[model samples]
Target chain A: MMSFVVGIAGVAVFSVLARVMQSAARGTSPVAILAIAAILSHLASVALGIIYVPQFQYWSAASIFSFGVMSYVFVFGAVYKSVSLEVLLAVAGHPDRAVPLPYIVGHQVPEIFRGRIQILIESGLVEQIGSTFAATAAGERLAARIARLRRMFAIGDSGLYDFPD
Target chain B: MVGLVTPAMNFLPGPAQTAAICLGIALPLLLLCYARIPGIRGAGSRFRIGCATAAALFAIACAVLPGERRIDDVAGGILLLATAMLLVYVFWGLLAWGFTLTLLTTLAQAGRPLTEEQWAAAYTQGGDIGKFARNRLKLLLGSGMVAVTGDTIAATSSGMAIARLARLVRLATGLR
Candidate 1:
């Protein structure tokens, strides 16, 4: 129980420390920063437990810590570029708590789409070719694997939310 | 009172632990294989099958392994199994529905550079951006995050909560 509490505290520390270190990691993703923080925090927690506890349970401490970190990552991934959530945020940000469809279609959607594209380009998964953009070789390979996985998992390629067609 | 290994773990896992560890590694390999099977449908269904198969296999390992179960050993095995499942889900979800990844796939599938208009068309497969917008909007509506009244949409109270949370996440992740 004590080790579990310590592990949970370690996750909390990791979240904050990841944020603090994110600015310095200009080239790193927040996910990467968080991962590093998780590692450091877990090690620190384990050491602290060994010194403080009469007989520390390594697996128990590790289990909860890992589960906590994975849950955090899941939440982070969900909100990171969620189009639906972005729309909610936009409407919520408005003083009137309402947003025009035109604004959403014209601005919000494009903003998110472009942002995603920019990331793709930066990561070399996509590239500009004179007048337009195309997937790079790496992108093609990645896309193929993704396509295979999606097929196995019964997902579509559209990236849109699935509604019964 | 003093021990490098916990007393519960002193007995170790024996054969059961070994098999569990082996199955954890094989989980992804199974997913990769099942992906090739045409009969499998739905990424969600396929993943669930993988996890269930893993759990069942682990169960067999526990039942067949030549030892009585120790609580710590069993607990450790369960934790290891759970970790593998979670890790696989994280990566698999990214592959299945990841926005950036799908976009890259779309462009790659296109086989050539597309003009902005062509790109949009290709991306949505003939549906305009509005449809894509509504597709996402539908998610917000389904999740009770946003309400629609005729031509306009407003965030519900829960939506506002989500908004606040998203803001905090963005700020903390330096994604602001």
Candidate 2:
């Protein structure tokens, strides 16, 4: 239990470290950064525990560390490109710290749209050709797999937020 | 008399340990079952139900598993199991409600190139982007993250709190 707690502390430390290092390595994917940080953190934490503590459970420390890192990554992924979050941030950033709803729907949402398009194009999943855009083979394969999962999960492919009945 | 420490040292699990293992295994199966329930509509609600089901099962297992209890083991197992649920939900949510993902899926499903407008139409099931915008906005409003009065929209106190947390997450994750 002590080792496990130590591991979680390591995750906390390394996640913040990764955030600081992100600026220096601008091109690196956040997931990659987090993965590397998690491994390094676990290693450092467990190593210190082994050298310092006479009785440290390696597997227990590892199990808790793994879960903590995964949870952090999950949260990072959630807020990464959240449209609703973006809207809230915009309003929160306002000088008056308030804005009109139409301003968000009219301006911010479209901006988000364009940003998403840019991401797809840059990621090589989709390409803009003339006035039209098409998905690459990689994109199609991923889309197909997502489609399958959605079907298995009974989720609609539309991706539109459905109001709960 | 010879004292032997056989490998069969702890063949039987304590009650909490048994319960933890059962709940861990049952969590995924519960999600699969809930997926088939038509009454659970939105992706958010479906994920919530899965978590709720897992929690309830864990509680029941705690009650029913027969033996001495190891509280720490049970707690650790619950954390591990809950972590798995959160991870799966994150990926599943990405596939379900991710904006960029939907765009790519729509374009791929089209079988040909589509204009920006065409893709937006396809994304919203023939409705304009406004429909999608309203849907997302409804989430923000419904969650009490943001409120609108007349033409103006403002972040509520909770919204501001959430906004701070979001920024903190962004900074901590090197997103900003």
DockQ of each model against the real complex?
0.50, 0.47
CAPRI-style grade of the A/B interface in model 2: acceptable
lDDT of 2 by residue, A1-165 (tens): 675676677777777777776767888887787777777887788666665544565545555776778788777876887888888889888887789777877778878888999999999999889999999988999889888877887878888777774
lDDT of predicted model 1: 0.77
Instruction: Tell me the tens digit of each residue's lDDT in model 2 across B50-129.
Output: 88877887777777766655655566667666666776777777877888898888889999999988988899989877
Clashing residue pairs in candidate 2, if any? none
lDDT of 2 at A151: 81
lDDT of 1 at B66: 76
**Model 1 lDDT tens row, B44-90:** 77888999999999998888777688665566577667777888887
Superposed by TM-score, candidate 2 places the C-alpha of residue A90 at a distance from the truth, in angstroms, of 0.7
Tell me each candidate's TM-score.
0.81, 0.88
DockQ score for model 1: 0.50
TM-score of 1: 0.81
